[model samples]
Target: MTQDRPIVIGAGLAGLMTALHLAPMPVLVLARAPLGEAAASAWAQGGVAAAVGPDDDPARHLQDTLAAGDGLCDAAIAARILGAAPDTIAALLRRGVAFDRAGDGRFALGLEAAHSRHRILHAAGDGTGAEIMRALIAAVRRTPSITVLEHTEARRLLVEDGRIRGVLVAGPHGAMTLPAGRVVLASGGIGGLFAHTTNPPQAWGQGLLLAARAGAALADLEFVQFHPTALATGTDPLPLISEAVRGEGALLIDETGSRFLADSPGAELGPRDVVARGIFRHLAAGHQVFLDARQALGDRFAKRFPAIAAACRDAGLDPATQPIPVTPAAHFHMGGVAVDAVGRSSVAGLWACGETASTGLHGANRLASNSLLEAATCACWVAGDVAATPAVRLRPLAEGRLPPLPDPAVVRPILWRHVGLLRDAEGLRAALRALLPLAAGGGPASDPATLGLMLAVAALRREESRGAHARSDFPTHGAGRARRLTLNLAEAMQAAAGLADPVVLRA
Candidate 1:
C-alpha cells in the first residue's frame, strides 16, 4: 500500500533478492503461493554456477556459456555475468546461505554439462535450490523492509504513456488496482504451457504477456530448453532427474543396457538440447531410455543425490539397484520480456529479472547452472536502478477483470506436440492457427496461448535447427547473420495472422 516502495510480482530468488538488496526502501512481493514452494528456484537442483574453483576462471566460464548458446549468445552479456560469478557467490554467502565446502575450507564446486571446470556451488547436496530458497525466505522473514503477500496473482500491468504505474492484483478478497512507484515482474517461465514440463503448473509465462501488453519488447521466445532426464511417471509436471547426475558420471542407456550417447561429442555431458534430442530419438526408434547411475554412483548415489534418489524411489525404482527410467521434458525457458543489463524493461518504471526476463545472457540456450547466477546478479542490478529513479505519484489504474482461463488438459498437449521440444514448419503453423483465437480474447487462456503463439511464430521464422528450438523440417542452420528476435504482442500477432503457410524470416 505504500507509494514509494516498489511492487514485485513472484517471490522467487530474483524477486526476493530484489527486495533484499533494496533494504531501507520497502518492497512488496506478491506470490501465487507461499514463498519458495511454487518457485522454479526451489526446484533447481544443479546449483549456482560460479568461477570460484581453483581450476576455473570467469573467462573460461564465459567461453563455455557462449558455446552452449549455439551461436546466438551475446558475448558482452555473457562476459559481464560470468565475470561476476565469484562475486555473486560471495553475496549469497554473506546472506548466510551455506554452500558445501571442501576439507580445505574452500567452497566445493561441482561439474555440469558444457562447462570446463567444476564451478557449480551446491547446498544440501542435490537440494541446491531448496537450500538457497530456504535461506532467502528466512532472510526475507527477518527483514522489516520486505513484505510478502501470498496467494495473490498479478493479472495485469497498469501502463500509461509507455510507463508502468502499478499492477492489477487478484486474490481471495477480490481484484484491486495496486498503485506503486515501480513494478518488477519476477514471474517464472513458460514450461507450464507444455504438457510434459518440469515446472510447476502455475509458471505459464504470465509476466511475458503482462509486459508485452504494457508495450515491453519480447525476445527469443522460441528457445525452450528441455531437460533430458525427467522421471517419466505420467505426472502433470514430470519430476526432474537433475543434470548433475550425468555430471557425476551417469550414463544414458537404451534398451539392452547399452550406452546411447556414446557417439556424441560431449557424450552424457553434452548440452541439454543435445541430450534431450538423444533421448527423444532413442524413444522414437522403438527403444527405452534410461540413466544408468548404478555403476558410477553405486551405493554413494543415495548420499550424493538424495533428492533424485527419493524421486526414483517414488517412481518404483532405485538408482542403487537399477537404471532410472527417464525422458526429456520441457524445463527452463531461455527467453522472455527483453531487458537491459540493469533489468530495465522498455517501459519506464518497469523491470524484469529471473526466468521472466531475456537480457541476452542465455541467448539461444542457457549453460548449466547459470540460471540462478543470472537471477541474483540481475536482481542486484535492478535494485541499484530503482534506487536511482525519481519518486512519482502512485495513482490507481482503472478497475479491471481477469479473463476466464483454460484447463491445462486442453492446451498442454497441443503445446507439447507443436512447440515443445521439436518443431517443424507444418506443426508450427497449425499450432499458430489453433492458438490465435484463444490468444485474441483477453483472459486466463490469453497469456498461455499468447506465449505459445509467439513461440510458434518465432520457430516458424528461424527455419533452422539451433539450440533448444529444433526444426525437424529445417534440420540445419541457415547461413546468415545471427540476430535475436524482438517483438511486441502486436507485431508478433500481426506476423502470425499473416501466416497462411510456413514462411521463413524475410530477407
Candidate 2:
C-alpha cells in the first residue's frame, strides 16, 4: 500500500498528522497495535491548551508556557506554536475532531494549572485524547496516500550515508525493510520506563532510543513530568485521575480529613511538580492522602470525569461518597530527541514531534493540558516543512541487527526507587550502576539497551534540582538557564561507567 515519501513510525496524533499533511506522497504508518490500543495519545484525559477562548491571546499563552517552563522553553518555538493554535484547532475540526461546545455553539473551555485563562478544548466528557485520536485515525484511514501497517513494530531507524533511509520493521509478515525518502518519528514518550506511569505499556521510549542511537541530539532527557494525582490503586501502571478533576473543585486531603496542600502557594492549583512533591512528602511520612471531591462536587464529579469515576469504582471507592486515594506517578516526559522550530531533529531528513521530540516548550515542568497543544502545533509545523521540501531519492535501507528488548520489571524498580519524583547523587549513581549490567546483558552496544543507558547517563549528568528532576543533595536550582546534550553509545557508556562515583557538576 506504499510507494515513496517517508515512513511514519507511529499512528498517534503526531504520526497521523504528519502522514495526512504529506498526502499524495505515499506514507507508510506503522502501529504496534490497532488504533487506540498502544498509543498514549488515546489515554490522555486532559484537553489541549491553546489561545482558543474568546478572552485568550497567543502572547498570553506564550508567556504562561514560558513561565511554566522555568526559563527553558524556546521563545521563538513557543511563539510560533502558540501563534498557530487557532488554525490547528480549526484543522482538527476539519478532520472531524468533536470538541465540546456550549449551547450557544461556542467552544467550551476548561482551566488547568498555570493557565491564566480557560482554554482547554475537550470532547465527550474527559476523553479529549481519545476523541482526537479517533478523528485523526479516521481521517488517516480515509487518506488514500497513507498506508497503515498494524501490529507492526519499528525495530530501528535505517540510516545510510548520514541520512535516514527508512526503518526495519517486524510484524505478522516477519521482518522487512520498508524504505522511504524520509522518516518521521512520531513515537510517544518514555513513560513505560518507570514502575508507575499513566502511559500505555508500549510507550517505552523506542522512538527516542532509535533517534538517539542514530546520532540525533537529545535535549532535556533528565526532566520527566510526574502527574501529582494518579489513583493509588496498586495498578502496575497507575491510572491517572487527571488534573481536570481538581479544576472541577476537588481538594487534596490527608487521612485526618485535613486539607494538606491548601497552604501550598498554588494549593490545589499548583504546578505539577510542586503538587507531586507535596503528595510524595505525604506518602513518605506514612500518611494516606486522598482527593476529596464529595463535599464540593458530589454527583457532578463522576459526570465530569468518567475515567476517574471508573477507576475509583474499580478500587472499591466512590468519589461522590468518599475520598479517592491518590499518589504521584510518571505521566509525561518533558525531554526527548532535540528539535528546532520546524520539528527537524539534528539529523537531516529525520523529524520528530509530540512527546518523542523535546521542543523545549514543556521545559522542566509541563503546564497541565499543554502536552496536547504541543503535539498538535508541532505536528502541523513538521508536516508543512516536509511538504515544502523537495522529494529526494530514497537511500538504500541499511542491514543491521537490533539488540534484544530490555525487561520492564527490572527497569521499573530502578526508575521508581532512584529517578522517580525525588532524586539524589547517591541514588542516581546507584541507578546508573544497576542499569549498566542490564544494558550489558542485553546485547551489542548498538542496541536499545545502549539507548536506555544513554537516557540514564543524561539523567545522571544534570546535577542541580529543576522542575521534575529534584535532587536532595543538589537541592537548589542552578542559575536559571537551559542546556542541550547529545550522547552516542560510546559517550553514554563512558558517562555510565563513571557513575560508580559521579562527578556532580552543575550547569
Which structure among the candidates has the greatest lDDT? Answer: 1
State the local distance difference test value for candidate 2: 0.81
What TM-score against the true fold does each predicted structure earn? 0.97, 0.95
Give candidate 2 regions above 4 Å deviation. 1-3, 395-402, 443-452, 504-507
Q: Each prediction's Cα RMSD? A: 1.6, 2.2
Native-to-model Cα distance after best TM-score fit, residue 105 in candidate 1, in Å: 2.1
lDDT of 2 by residue, 34-99 (tens): 977888899889898889877899999998888888777778877888888889899899999999
lDDT of 1 by residue, 81-170 (tens): 889878888899888888988899998788999998999999999899998898899999999998888988888888777787778888
Number of backbone-clashing residue pairs for each candidate, in the order shown: 1, 0
Query: Which residue segments of model 1 deviate by more than 4 Å?
Result: 405-408, 501-507
- For each candidate, the alpha-carbon lDDT, in order, equals 0.86, 0.81
> What's the true lDDT of residue 22 in model 1?
89
